[model samples]
Target: MTKILGISAFYHDSAAAIIIDGKIIAAAQEERFSRKKHDPKYPYNAIEFVLNFAKVKLSEIDHIVFFEKPFLKFERILETYVAMAPRGFLQFSKAMPSWLREKLFQKKMLFNLLKKNDINFNEISKISFSEHHLSHAASAFFPSPFEEAIVLTADGVGEWATTTVAVGKKNSLKIKKEIHFPHSLGLLYSAFTYYTGFKVNSGEYKLMGLAPYGDPKYIDLIQKNLIHIKDDGSFRLNQDYFNYTTGLSMTNKKFHNLFGQNPRDSKKDKITQFHMDIASSIQKVTEDIMIKICRSLRKEFNIPNLCLAGGVALNCVANGKILKEKIFENIWIQPAAGDAGGSLGAALAFWYLELNKDREVTNKDRMNGSYLGPSFGNEEIKNKLNNLGAKFEILEEDVLIEKTADDLSKGNAVGWFQGRMEFGPRALGGRSILGDPRSSIMQKNLNLKVKYRESFRPFAPSILRDNVNDWFELNEDSPYMLLVANIKKEKQKQMTEDEKKLFGIEKLNIKRSEIPAVTHVDYSARIQTVSSDTNKKYYDLIKKFKDKTNCPVIVNTSFNVRGEPIVNTPEDAFNCFMGTELDNLVIGNCYLIKKYQNPALKKDYTKNFELD
Candidate 1:
């Protein structure tokens, strides 16, 4: 058996993954264990976790692969600075010292870091490098169920390539086309995110959520001044309006002037109609570009399946638009499509491309529902709860599901920590905060009291796979919650003339559907279809809820407050339950109610972490 370790570090969302003979064994992110949001360190804790989980010594591993080529990235930076010389001196001078000292000699630095894991591990030749875009493409196509597919990857500049097209057949994958740096759709969307007073990488989703509340009033302005798109879906950015290449900020003075205002200060200024319209315009542009690209790719390749990866693919609204166009017979997106999934991709690329192995396609794909993180047994949960002075009661599996379903019917917010912790951004019932989807005020209450996020932010629905078509317009499987679709016509409530006339957040309180908690202001929902094969406990809980309320959907959000990483252990779960307004705590087979716990354990969670 060949044991290979893959690592992606020195970038946002550092992670580690281990594969044994082409089978994915373990994978996890460093932020979950370090308690930092988007931690970009060496992923020491993540490496330790994967090694321990696989019960293998680092010395015994046959190969170690880093996600990207550092020298290639350095070359892009040097060339970009030279092309815009004297204009980027400030940024160039600041970046030079780090590149010369550490990044330029990544192999030696990596060797030192590996020694910290095991002193006996000293094979420097075992370490190899994979290209950034190739890592992303492999992550998307290798795990998909399709025997052949066209792979599309787009993101903020990686090394030099920002967007790429690859074709994957059986075990062989090859890049066919490339769109290089300084012309990126991901960075374009992020520029709007920064202009709207939100953090760049972390707040792009917030911009997507705010799009439905406003009109696309700036689309023409954006098209004329910011980006130029061709009929074949190839595009370039007007650098005169942007500053990402040579400055610290994303947008420049020309960008602000064209938009008719300066960037909003998130600390002071409020989100008005102007900001909402900006978000709407950018979102529409992104979706249109994605659809055009998909159409062109299908027409050119004549492939029935398409796979997507990279940060831009995380835009579920764009993904839904592609699905609605029927450009391909099927679509598969990487669950961890960001920089974190690069670790897995690096490992898979070596197994199939480097070693020349045969690929075995599975009916359900090979990700195992992305439940590749740590899991605790009943005894571990019991011991940890006791040590934390948590008050709880243990129940049988059937009784536990029934009682949890009963609490949802009573409109109680629940902190559910079950089975294995999920590997990606979305919490697929593994570590989630669930509520009744039928409650009209559940969305508002959870946003303010529990998540402490913006009121306009939307929640996703976790519906049973068999009943997804009955409640939502989508008939395809969306286990990763990466696709957006509208609620069924029969389940929607028609808005009155007065309600329809209301603008901005004025329409927030009006119930738009039978499951108002999960429905966005535009009557659309980010959907997650739960199947018994992937997660039996979550499926059974929803089934029990359906038995009592005749509703097969529930509101599912990550089990964390704003700006914090999801909980990874029993103690983290207890602390979050005590800090937030969640009413019930269900970890493993143990259950705890807030009223039964000591009042002294309550905490001020609002200011616990920096807001994203």
Candidate 2:
């Protein structure tokens, strides 16, 4: 029963993960439970959930690993504030109290929290801290199906390094070069995200999504005014026009004046073409910088495979561009590329570096397909269905697959809850909203009817693993949906002159693929391939759907609507189904009919008594 617990807290996207004898048992982000976008408070709630889910006492844990060394990160923070003295005075002043109480005293904080959980730090034996990018590197590489590969991690700032290049072989990883902080590609994207009237960390994806709608009108502006790139693939920011260090925003008044407007305040103004163009320009800049860095990393490492992590790796747009160029023979991205994935990385680093465990790189990546969250057993699900007074059927395995496939083909959006929940941001089939993408109106229907999300947001395609190359331009695997790929020539729908002339986000209605709902305005799709080897249930269901409909892909989105985190428990899943227009929800073997759901018998539905 040897087990290790890895934790990432205080920093945003706080999470906890448990690995029992080298197998990932449980992992989840705090945001799912807390309902915060990036809950950064110590992952007390998440840790409790993981410990209870694994049914292990804290005393049974062999080791505890923190994601990043506190002192090292504190040093970076201090040095940065000192170097850019008085520039970020207001923010610095606001942050000082928290730093003193939380950051500087983290070791004591960790000790107290662990002690409170009845885990004797003395008997717990080993405790260690991983370098930030090292954790990111380990998270991507150790789980990848590669004996050796080039590793690249890029984020806003981790300690001093914003980006790092390394070579990972078997159980060992060696850092080759690191591009330090304040010159981060991520911050550049965030700065523009803020400038374009979107939240910094949360809004980067919106920018990426908006890129297809507008022209890259500010690419030259960003290149010339915002950043300075050297030949060595390192770049520096012209801090004068930025305010992240001191001011409330990533962009300053001068930056706004240069752009001919102040930052668009989201609470006040409507999103316009100007904002879209800015998002487009910044996203293109990010992709360009990433390509440049990838080229340099390839030349330096000369490895055929690449492992990508850090928060920016979640940018499916950039991941797609990198794939199109074929710089790396293969790529594997961390499903939780943000701070939450850091927990898994830190745990693996402890396993290999501290425990000195032997590593195995298999033909399939050692991720268990990222289904590391808590799952409902048949008993638990059946009890909930009975309690809710819902009519349901417990079908046999083959029957379940066939019926689910038939429902999907008929355009019923089913909440496919099976196995453990997913650990990452994306719902990788288990906690997913499933629909037939071949329906031309399915995208809008899912947006306005099923999921009740933004109309502009696109759904991701879950294709059978073997059919990746036939439908997409990609020859590589994307089991995590962290990478985007172009629709194959044969899969694309013919465009009329009217469709070609469609401008702005209105172009979203243009058909690009046999499955138009998942295809983006740019003719690319964030594709997740299902493999029976990893998740047999999801794989079999997709296979059955393809057998029935002859389409290898289906629409897969998180099982929750916009502004809410993905459903974390059976109750959450059921409540979301009842609130939204979801046609069906399967929990374990019990299929719940939302139409027959009785609200009074349930604890509560959050959507009730609320006006949108």
Candidate 3:
């Protein structure tokens, strides 16, 4: 048997993955184990978990692959600093120590880290590095249910390439073209994310969620000042407006002047019409750029299928727009499209590209529905809950599903934990907080009471796969919740002329659909279509919910408070359940009702986690 271990670390979303003979055995992110959001430390815990899951030792692995070439990335940073010359000395000084002490000698540092696993210096020589974009392309194409497809990857600078185009045919994949760094769609979006008073890497989605509440009034101004686009989607950043190349901050004074305001201090200022308009304008610009690129690529390749990976691919709004425009016959995206997925992609790159192995396609992708993380058994869950002195009831699978669905129907927020945890940023059904979609106050209650997040951000809908079309305009399988679709017109509640005249975030409270909890102000929803093939338990729960309420959809959000990582164990789930306003906790076949829990166990969970 050929065993390969892949590691992506020292960056946000550090992770580890193991593959046996080109088949994925296990994959997980370090944050899930560390209880830190986007933990960048070496993924020792994640690596240990994967090795144990695969029943292998580090010494037995044939190849250990790092997701990106560290030297190449360091070179890009150095050259960028040189280009900026004397203007960014402070930034250069701050960055140089880390590069000199750690990143510049990544090979040595990595070897030292491997020593902790009892792999000696000689054995550590087996390590290999893959190009950043190649890893991303392989992640997108190899696991997809496609024989041949066009792959596009765009992200904040990876080594030197920020965007790349590749084609995958059977077992072989080839890169066709690339747009190098200092100009990137991902960075552009992240810059706006910062400018709009949100965190950069983690706050982009918040910006996307806030877009539907405002008008795209700044689109023309943005197109004129920040980016220059050709007839095709290829574009150049003016550079004068962006400070990411040489400074710690994403945007500069020039950018602030162009936007006509300084960045918002999220803690002090309320989200007004200006920030909402900026968010909407940037979202529209991003969609336009993505659509233009997909159109150009389709005309060039004439391929029927398109595969997408990288952080930007996480923008379901853009993905939905591409689907609406019919840029390709079919689109498949890596559920874990961000840097966390680079571990899996790196391993797949070595298996397919380096070893030149044969390829096999399945009707459903080979991601195991992205549920490739650690799982706990009923005995283990029972022991943890007992140790915590928690109140709970154990029931059969059918009874558990029925009771949980009934609780949801009566307007209870449930922390639903089952099977293996998800490998990506999304919680899927494995670690999710579910609520009834028909409740008009469900969204607001979940946001302020349960999640403690900004009220303007929207929640996603988890719907039965067979009934997806009846609720939303989308007919495609969106198992990963990476696509947004409009609510079916028949299901929508048309707004009156007075309601239509409401501006900015004022439209937020106006109900737009039957499933108002999951519907955005613009009548679109980020949809997850559940299937029995991937998660039978979750599918059954939604089915039971439908039987009770005649609505097949439920509000689904990650199972944690704001700034906390998704709960990984029964203990984490119980803690999160007790911390928030969640009414119940369900793990395996056991259910714990909040009202029955000991009052002494209740603590202020808001103080437990740092806000992002």
Candidate 4:
């Protein structure tokens, strides 16, 4: 009956996770409830939700774990500033106030925050802190299917380690090696994200998405000037070209001079050929480093199974490269690989690593498909829709699936909200906007009309587990939608030389595969293989769609407009449905046709969220 609560906050993607006797009870991010993207405040809302969901009070919790040791992190920051002295004064001064006022005494602040939530001040003394990378490692390996595996975590920075290699066997994990801060691949990628006119942290994916549009023309220049890599994947940055350690911006004047241009002003600049090339170059470097690291790990440990966490692990493109290289026979990644997942990891680290509990492993993973967030019953949904004066119909599961499949086959975009919400960045069919993947116009239509995002941005596909290998080059399970793979050659459309010569984004509209909506310009698709064991309802709906259209894949994007967090409740889904060009909304067993809904319910959803 041991109940443990894990918290990660103050550094972005704040979240809370609870585990009962080593079983993950619930986990969620603050942004979903607060409606703030990457909310870094204390995860009070998320913590409260998990407690209620698990039907436990704070006093019942035997342990509470914070994701990282704040003092250790502060020490690292202080030492780095001292080492860089005189040179890092501005950044040091800018960071000191927060460190001194809040982070330096984070334990006291945490206790007060908990007391405000009605937890007894005495109970707060049970809290402990886990090292940052250890949390990442625990999150990756604990819920993974493997009983033994090599775990790799890479991020911008933790207390001191930015990257760590650990081995997990049964309930225990041992750190093998670590690469400390100021030498980080995650920061390297983020720096390019900044240089390419995209927001750091949030915009790293945009850079990865933009890579397919250009050649890796800057790879040599990047290797020679920006980063130095050895054969084993460990590398150092030429700090002369970077400012993240000492200034507000990621790149310095030396970097700008080397790149032959200043940073692109996101507000005024068009994504030019140069920007795309830079994106491509960095992506290539990232993939190369990841592959090299996996190769090194494989040769060193020869472990068939590998698990990954940390922010960089969210790079599906690099993950895809690791899979393609076959350095590891199997890879299991935490769906919430970013800081949000640290909460879960921290809790698990306490349960197994600290308490010495026996490990329980599962071939299907212990994440329960990462559907560990809030859900609404049909009665609640019906009431919400009825109160909104929205026109709707209700059906049983089978009929709803049939109707939704029929609508999808007819080229209608469906907002699918079912069961518990997902706990990570991906929608995973739980809170997804779906469309016909085979439609040549589906990509553009979903991007411009539905998501209101850039046309160049690609969508992902959720394929039935049985049909995944038939359509994609991947044969393994990818239930979490964290891996990218090429569309099978049989489904690809041959292109003419003139079509191939189309420069930059001109090639976007040229369909390269039958499932053009999900296929990127490079013929790769971010693949999510849905299994009935994890989510029977979603699996059945896709199964029905496949039976109707004979296409095994569907365009699966998050159930929100471009910049908004994924819809967390029935109300959020209903509002998004009314505001977007979606044809239908399906929540639990309730189905609503947009045309029948009150026209007045349609407000400008675009104005609801600020674009990232």
Candidate 5:
């Protein structure tokens, strides 16, 4: 069997993944261990995790694939700088040193970093590069549950191409069309993200989250002045108004002049109707373009399923729109859906395209429920608890499941740590903080006390797979929690007149769903349904919970504090438990009750304590 290792680093969200044969073995992002949001440094921690997960030595790795072609990206940089020459002298000066010292010789630097990190199995013999967009496409297509799929990948410029359309069948894939660099939907959205008092790459989700609070009052102005849209839905950024292509700022003086404003400061909190309107307008425009692109892709390939990846696919709002449009019967999106997941795509491409391995197509292909990370066994858990000198109890298989379910029903936030931590951004029960859905105060409690995140950011729900259709509009299982569908109308709560008038984040208080804490203001929720076939332990817990409480759904958020990566190790989970107000943390058979945790643990966790 061929063993392929994919590495994406030196950019945002450096990550590593190992694929054995045609199935994914393990994948993890560097940020989890580094504790830096979007740590673009070497994925040494992530690489080690995946290697240990698969129990393979570096020598056993047959091939190592890196996402993006560094030389091509460097060429784009040089050309862009020359075109914008004197206009961005300061930005250009700052960009050059990093380019010359690191990015310019990315391949050699990558090989050396691997060696420094104990991966000294001669990378030169196995290393390969796929075009940036090709990696994105492969990421979308290879794991999808389709014999053939029309694939769409759009993101900030990679090498040169920013967006591309492709068709994948069996082991063969072909790019049908590409939108080259300097023109990107991602950069466009990022420009607005920068303008609206948010960090560019990091704050795109914040912008999307903020849009629902505002009306699309600036859409006409945005279309007429900021960007020019064609009949095909692809548009050009009015270069006169934006500077992101070659300047440090996302927008130019003309952009501020037109909008009658300056870029909002990151920490400033002067959000008004105008800012909200701008966010709404840009969001509408983005959804429109995505739908049009999907329609065109359907016309081009005549395929029923569409595969989406890149940073853009993380837009659940847009994903919902495409689902409503029904251009394709099904869509399989990458859960990581960012620069990190490119590692999986890159490795899969090597296995299928280069190694000529045959692939098997299922109703959901071979993602294995995206649960491909390191998992500790009973002995490891016992050792950790003993080392910490903490009190704990070991329960039998049935007792563990029943006890966890009982805790959830009693309104306790339980950290449900099980086999193989998930690779993608979503928690997916393995490394999940679960709570009862029926509690009206659960959302606020978790947001304010446990997660210490923005009160506006909503939590997701994990339901038993069988009962998903009973309460959600989605008929199929959403194991990845990427799709947001409306809660069943029968299950929706009727709003009062005052609640009807309540717009924006204030609307979050209304019970729009049967499980209010997991629902958003719009009566829609990101859903992940547990199935016995995928994760029997997690499923059985929920099954027992449902039998007792008559509610199959539970709040399932990733196990970590806000702005932190999900917990990857037992220590990380324990530390997170101490840091937050979670009632309990369950890893393997060991359960650490918050009321009984060590005072030494509580001392270190006091740094970011909050309670709702």
Candidate 6:
């Protein structure tokens, strides 16, 4: 069997993946293992996990690919500095030392790092590189259910390209167009993310979550001063109002002046109506740009299938809009659509494109529901729980599901850890905190007492695949929790005129739907369709929930506090359970209720991790 190993490191969300004969074996991110949010160090632990899971030594790997070519990235940095010379020397000087010492020679540094995994791994020639956008495109297309697709990838600058369009047919994928750095849609969203007092990469989702609370009042001003877009969705950023080209910050004083305020000091400032309005404006602009691009591409290529990747693809609202507009007959997005996914994309690109191998398409796509991380057997979980002095009872599969369903029906927040962990930013039932979606206070309690996050941030609904259409406006597969759709009008609770007049957070408390916890302020829900074919246990649990309450939906959020990476092991789950306000813990067939556990085990979890 031919084995390929892929690595994406030195950038945020470092990860590793292994493929055997072009079939993905295992994939995981460094943050999960390191317990650090967006860890950018070499994915030593992730690499080791994939290698171990695949049951192969690093030396046995036929080819090893890094996600992006360092030389090309270095060239872009140098060229960007030269073009903006004298004006950005401070940023240039600070960056050059690291580039010269480490990043410029990534292959050599990677070689040394690989040796830590296996001392016998000494073959340097096995190392290769894939372009960033190419990797993103490959990640979206290769494992997709489509045989041929128009691939669109947009993210912060990768080498030179910021936005790319690629065509993929069978085993062949080629880049057709590129909009290079300093003119990025991803950076534009991130600029708003920064200006709104949120962390850049980590906080973009928060900004997206806050968008529905306010009006998009600044779209005209944004279009006039910041970006110039054509009818075809091609656009350019007016860099005079930005600083990301050659500075540490994402926006400049001109950008602040255009908005009539300095960047909000996140530590001190409360999120006001202005922040919500700004979020709404940027989100609308982003949706418009993405829709325009999808429409233009569908017209230009006449392809029925569209595949999306990169950081921007994580914008579920935009994905939902593209779907709602019927721009493509079928759409598939990479579950791990950020830099972490680049590792798998790099490996797959080398397998299909580099090796010129034959392609095979599956009706259900080859991601295996994106549950590609580590899992523990019941015995292992029991042993770990015993070692931690945790109190628990092991039950039969039927009993466990029944008990958990009963807990949900009673409005208890349950820490549900089972099977393999998810590879993406989302917690797909596998590593999730679940609650009764019908509970009106579930969202507020989970955010403040459990997640220790902003109250306005929304939770997603994990609905049975068969029941998705009945409850939500969507009729498509959204197994990755990557599509937003409105709750069915019949299930929605209409707001009064006075309620509608309330602005920002004031509107958060009004229940909008039967599944109030998962529904957003605008009645939309980020939906994850659970299928028994992919995740039998999770599906079975939800089925039992449905049997009990006649509702197939549950509030599912990542199994961690805000700023913390999703739990990776039984120990991590236990610690988080003790730390948060979760009412019960379920791992494997084990169950532990909060009141029965040792009081000393309770933790001050709110201050456990730094805010994302």
RMSD of each: 0.7, 2.4, 1.0, 1.0, 2.2, 0.7
Candidate 5 C-alpha lDDT tens digits along 57-122: 877788989988888888988888888887778888888899899888877787787776565567
Local accuracy of candidate 4 as per-residue lDDT tens digits, 1-612: 999999999999999999999999999999999988888999999989999999988767889899999999999988989888889898899899999998989888888898766655466578899999999999999999999999999999999999999999999999999998899999999999999888888999899999999999999999998999999999999999999888889999999899899999989999998998999999999999989888999999988999999999999999988999888989999999999999999999999988999997767799999999999899999998888787788998889999999999999999999999999899998999999999999999999999998888989999999999999999989988889999999999977999988977888889899998899999999999999989999899899999998988889999999888899988889999989999999998899998888788889988988888
lDDT of each: 0.94, 0.83, 0.92, 0.92, 0.83, 0.95
lDDT of 3 by residue, 277-303 (tens): 898899999999999999999999999
Selected candidate, larger lDDT, 1 vs 6? 6
Cα deviation of 157, candidate 5, in Å: 2.1
Q: How much is the lDDT of residue 82 in candidate 5? A: 88
Alpha-carbon error at 525 in model 2, in Å? 0.2
Residue 231 CA displacement from its true place in model 4, Å: 0.9
> Candidate 6 — which residues are off by over 4 angstroms?
none
lDDT tens digits by residue: candidate 6, 161-276:
99999999999999999999889999999999999999999899999999999899999999999999999998999999999877889999999999999999999999999999
In angstroms, how far off is 399's CA in candidate 6?
Answer: 0.5
The C-alpha stretches of model 2 lying farther than 4 A from their native spots are 52-55, 119-126, 599-612
lDDT of 2 at 47: 86
lDDT agreement of model 6 with the native? 0.95
Tens digits of lDDT, candidate 2, 284-391: 888888888888778876889988999899999999899888888888898988889899899988888777788876788878889887777898888877775677
Q: Estimate each model's TM-score.
A: 0.99, 0.95, 0.99, 0.99, 0.95, 0.99
